[model samples]
Target: MSPQEKTPATLPWLTDEFLQKILRDAGGHETTVVTSSDIKPMAGGGDNYLSTMYRVSVKTKDKEEAVSTISLVVKLPPSGAEMMKLIANSSAFLTEIKLLSDILPKMFSLLRETSPEEQEEFGAKCFYAKNTMPYVLIMEDLASKGFRMAERQKGLDLRHSIVVMRSLARYHATAIALHKRDPALVESFEENFYTDSRGFVSNATLPMLRSLAEVVRSWPGFGDDYRGRLLKRADTIYDDVMELMKPEGNAFNVLNHGDLWVNNMLFRYEEVTGEVRDVKFVDFQLCRYMSPGIDLQYFIHTSVAEEIRAERVGDLLREYHKTLCATLEDLRCADSIITFQELVDEYERKALFGFFVTTMILPILLSDPDTIFNPEQSHQKEDEAIVTKRISNIHFTTVLKRLLPIYAKKNFF
Candidate 1:
C-alpha cells in the first residue's frame, strides 16, 4: 500500500473531515489554530506510536461558563512498516485504550466521591473520551494547570512512597471488592478488556534472552560455575519471564498497572499559586491482570534507589499488605484479601520476576531520546540489546544478593 494509504488502525477517530465536523459542531468562528506546537515527548512505557501533544484555543457561546484552553495528546501510528509489524503483533498498542475505557466508570466514581486525600490515594479521573477510531484522547490537559511530574531526579521520599503505596492498595482493593460484590460485572469487564494473547517480549523475546545469556557466558572474568548455572537455567528463566501470566491455583489475581514506574503519575498542582497538589496516574497502556507481585516488584525496584530499596523493601511490602487488607475489610471483602502469608509466599515464588521487569524497563527509563523522539535515527533496539545482555548479569547478581537468601530461607527452589 502507498504511504498515504497506510492507515493507522488505532486512530480511527482522527481525520480532516472529523476535525472540521468537531470544529463546526462546536459552533465556533475560525477555530483559531493557536499554533499547534508539538508537546515534548514524554518518557517510556510505550511500544508503538510516535506520541505528540498539541494545545488548541477556541471560543464558544458559553464563554462565561465554558472551559477554554483545551489540550490533546495525539499518538500517530508507527512509521516504518517493520515497526508497524512489530506493533501489530504486540497487544500493548490498542489494548491500553480499550482497558482505559473499560475501567473509566470506576475511575470516574472514585474521583467524584473520594476526599482529596482519598482521591490522591485511590482515584484516576478520565475527563473525556474521544474514540473516533485510531483513537485520539483529548483529555483534561494536565499541563495547562502545571500538574506534571519531573522525571526521576531522586527516589520517592518516605511520605510520597507511603502515599503511593496506599493509593495502589486502594486501587487493588476496589477490584477485589467489585469481584466479590458482583462477580458478573467484573467478569464481563475482564472479558471485554484483557491481556493480548501475544507480546513481542513473549514470542520474540526468548531468543534475544538466550542470545544475551550466551554473550554473557562468553565474556571474560566470568567464573565457570556462574556461566554453567545461568546457561543451564536460561530456558527456565526465559519461560518464567515471557510467560508472566496469572499464577495457577489459589493466588488472588487483580488488575495491575503492568508498568507502574514513578513517571507514570502526573502530580496535580494549583497552577496559579504554583502549589503541589494531588497525584493523577496517567498512561494505562501496560495495565493487565496478574499477580500483585508484578506491580509491586516493578514499582519498588525501579522507582526506589538501592539504599532506600534495601531499607524499606520489607517495610513497604508489609505496608502494602496491611493497607490491602484494611481496604478489603472496609469493603466487606476480608475473605478476598490475599493473606499476609500468601503474599510472602507469592513473593518468594516470584521475586525473580523483578529482575525481568528491571531489565526490560531500565532501557526506556534510563535511555536518552526515547523511542518516540526520532524514530529513524534512534538505536533503541540496539541499546536495548546491550542493556539486556548486561542486565542478565546484574539481575543474576541481584538475585544472588537479595532474592537468593530469601529463597533459600524459605526453601522455595
Candidate 2:
C-alpha cells in the first residue's frame, strides 16, 4: 500500500491484496491467498498515531488444504498531517520504522540466545514490511492473553513491573554490547536515528500550555492563587522539559518504548485459573532513545497511583539497576558500572516528570472518553486546540512545582 493510503484514522495499508503478497513472500505457495481480512479496532490503543487492529486471517494454499489461520496486529504509521517532522528531516517517519525493524529482531535474538530465562520477560514477536513509507509492523496479538490496561486506575502489578524493569535493563545493556561487538552496525543504526526531535516537542507544546491554564481556571479545586503558581511554574519549567527533548544525558540515552505506559502492555493468562502467563510490549511509533529513567518513571508515575509509587519508586529503581548489573555480568561486558545508588539519583532527578504528567495529563486523559476522544461531543470549534492549550498549562505548572524543589536540592541547575 502507498504511504498516502495509511492514516491515523484508518489503516488502508493492511489491505487483503498486500497481505497476500507478504504471505507469498514468506515461502508460502502463490496460490496461498488471504481468503478474508478482518479488521477490528483494538481497545486501549489511543496513545499512538496509527489505527491499530487485531487481525484474523483465513489463508488457503489450495482448495483441498484447510485454510490456515493467522493472527496478528497490523500497525500503520501516523499520517503526515498527524505528525509534523523537522524541515530538513528526510523521511524520518519512515526511518523510525526501519530502526525498529533493525533493532527489535536483534533484541529478540539476544533474549533467546543469551537470556533464555528472560525470554518470556519481553514483549511481542515483531516483524516488519515496508509499504510505500516503510510502514506496517506485524506482531503477535495478545487479545487472548486477557491482560488489558484500558482503565486508567489499573496498571502493572509488582510482578509485571519487575519483569519489565529487568527487560528494559537488559535491552540497554545489550545495546551497549552491540555497540562494543559491532560498532559499525551500531553506527549505521544511529545514523538512521540521527535527527533531533526536541524542536518539534518545544514548538508544538506552547499552545498546549495555554490550553492547560484555561483548564486549571475552570477546574473546581484550583483557586486564582494556585492557578497563578501553576502558570508561573509552567512558563519557567517548560524550558527544562523542552531541554529533555534534546539528545543528552547518557543515563537517559537508551532506546525506549517512548510511550511505555500500561496500555501498551498486554498480558497472557490461564483461561480457567486466571493466572498471568506473559506480558508483551506493543506499539513502536513513539519508540526513541532517551533518558532510560523516563520510561520507568513515566510508567510508575502515570500508571501506578501516588500511594503505591511513593512507596515503591526506590525499590523499582533498585531492581532496574540490579537487573542491569546481572545482565551485563552474564554478557561479560565491562561497561556495567551503574549502581543502585546512581539509579536512585537518576530517579530523583527524572521522577519529577512522572509527577508532572500524572497530575496534569492524567486528569483530562482520565476524563470521560466521549469528551476526550469524540469530535462530535466537542462544543469548541477545535477541541484539540482547547485540550492542547489546557494540558500544556497544567503540564508546565505541575512540572515546575515538582522540579524546582528537586532541582534546587540537587543544585543541578
Candidate 3:
C-alpha cells in the first residue's frame, strides 16, 4: 500500500501529493518523488491548548535535482466534536488561516513598496492551507531557521523587549498603511474580541477569575477587604473586561494581537553578538482590529519582566510609541496615527484590561513546565479548582501581590 493508504489517525492528510505541494509552495522546488518522511506530535502545555501541532520532516527528489528535505509544522483545529464546539464557535482557527492567507500578504506588499531595504519579514510563510472543514495549515518550521521561543518562566528583559517594541511598531505601521488604502481592511475581523464571541471568551475567562479569587482569599497577608474586592470583581468580570476591550468612538485603532504574551512570540538571535535581532509573532487566531492599547497593555503586563516592568512601564510605552511613530512616518501613515500623549491616555483607561488578563496569564506562564495542566481536561468543577490552585505557584502569587496594591490604588479592583 502507498503512504496515503497507510495514513494513521494522527496524520490523516499526509499523502505523497501533499508533501509535493508543501515543498513546491514553501519554496519553488518541484519534486518527482518522496523518499522519506517522519511526523511526530509536538509537546504540549498551557500554550498548546487551542490546537494540536505536529512537526514534519519530508525528503523529496526531483529527477533533475538532488534529494531535498523540507521541515514544516502542521496545525489542525482541536480534535473531537466537543472540542470543536468550544473552539469553532469562536471561529479562531478560521481567523488565523484568513489572516495568514489574505491579510499578511497585503501587508508585506505595502512593506516591500514602501520600505524595500528593511530586513524583517512579516509573520511566518504558510506553505499549505485548507480553509474548509477538516482545515489544516502547514507552515515553515521556524525552529529550523534558528528561531526559538523565549523561556516563559524567565520573561523578557529590557533589550529583548525593545526589539519586540520596534518590530511590533513596524508590523502595526504596515497594517495601518494598508487599512488606509482600503478602509474595509477590518471587515473580516468584525466578529473578533467582543462581537458574538461570548462562548469561548466568557466560558474560559469567568471561571478562571473565580478560581484565582478563591486562591487569593487563601493567601496570608491578603486581608478580607482586599481579597473581597477581587471576589466581587469576579462576579461581573466578563462584562467588565469586554466593556474595556471594545474600542471607543474616534479611537486610534490597529490590529491588536489579542493574546500578546511570551509564548506567542519567537526570537531570532544574531549568531556572534547573541543579541535578539528579530521577533516573529505566532498565534494570529486572536489578531483583531482594535485599539493598539489592547496589544500594548497585554504585552507589558504579561510578557515584560517584573523588574523592568515595575517602574519603567511608562518608559516602555513611550519607547513603543516613539518607534510606532517613526515606522508610521516611513509608511506614510503618520497622518493617521495616534499621538504619544494620546496613546498614554488610552493605555491608562485600559489598565484594568491588563490587570485582569495578567492575573490569568501569570499563573500558567510561571508554572513549572512539567506541571502544566490541560485546560481541555478541566471540565469538572473540582478539576478546575485543582488546576487553578496548582497554577497559583509562589511566583504567580508574588507577582499578583506586588501588582494588586497598585491596581487597588487605581481603584481597579
Name the candidate that leads on lDDT. 3
TM-score of each: 0.69, 0.73, 0.92
lDDT of candidate 3 over 178-244, digit per residue (tens): 8888868764576563445665455555565667767767667666777678778877766787777
Clashing pairs in model 1, backbone N/Cα/C closer than 3 A = 10-134, 11-133, 11-134, 11-135, 12-132, 12-133, 12-134, 13-132, 13-133
Q: Candidates' lDDT values, in order? A: 0.52, 0.55, 0.75
Cα error, candidate 3, residue 294 (Å): 0.6
Better of 1 and 2 by lDDT: 2
**In angstroms, how far off is 116's CA in candidate 2?**
5.2
lDDT of 1 by residue, 1-413 (tens): 32223224433344434443454454442443321222333334332233333333322333244333444454433556554454455545454555455564564354444333343423233333454433454444565655676455355665556656767777777776655655554443232112443333433333344444455454554445434544555456555654565544466777777667777766664668755455656666666666788778878766665556778777777888898887777666667877777887776566777655543344345433333223332324445554453444442334335643343354322
> Where does candidate 3 stray beyond 4 Å?
1-7, 25-27, 31-33, 193-197, 218-221, 369-371, 382-385
Off by over 4 Å in 2: 1-17, 24-33, 43-56, 61-66, 78-96, 116-118, 144-150, 182-225, 245-252, 373-413
**Candidate 1 lDDT for residue 339:** 71
TM-score of 1: 0.69
For candidate 1, give the lDDT: 0.52
lDDT, model 1, position 103: 64
Model 3 scores worst on lDDT over the 10 consecutive residues at 373-382
Question: Candidates ranked by TM-score, best first?
Answer: 3, 2, 1
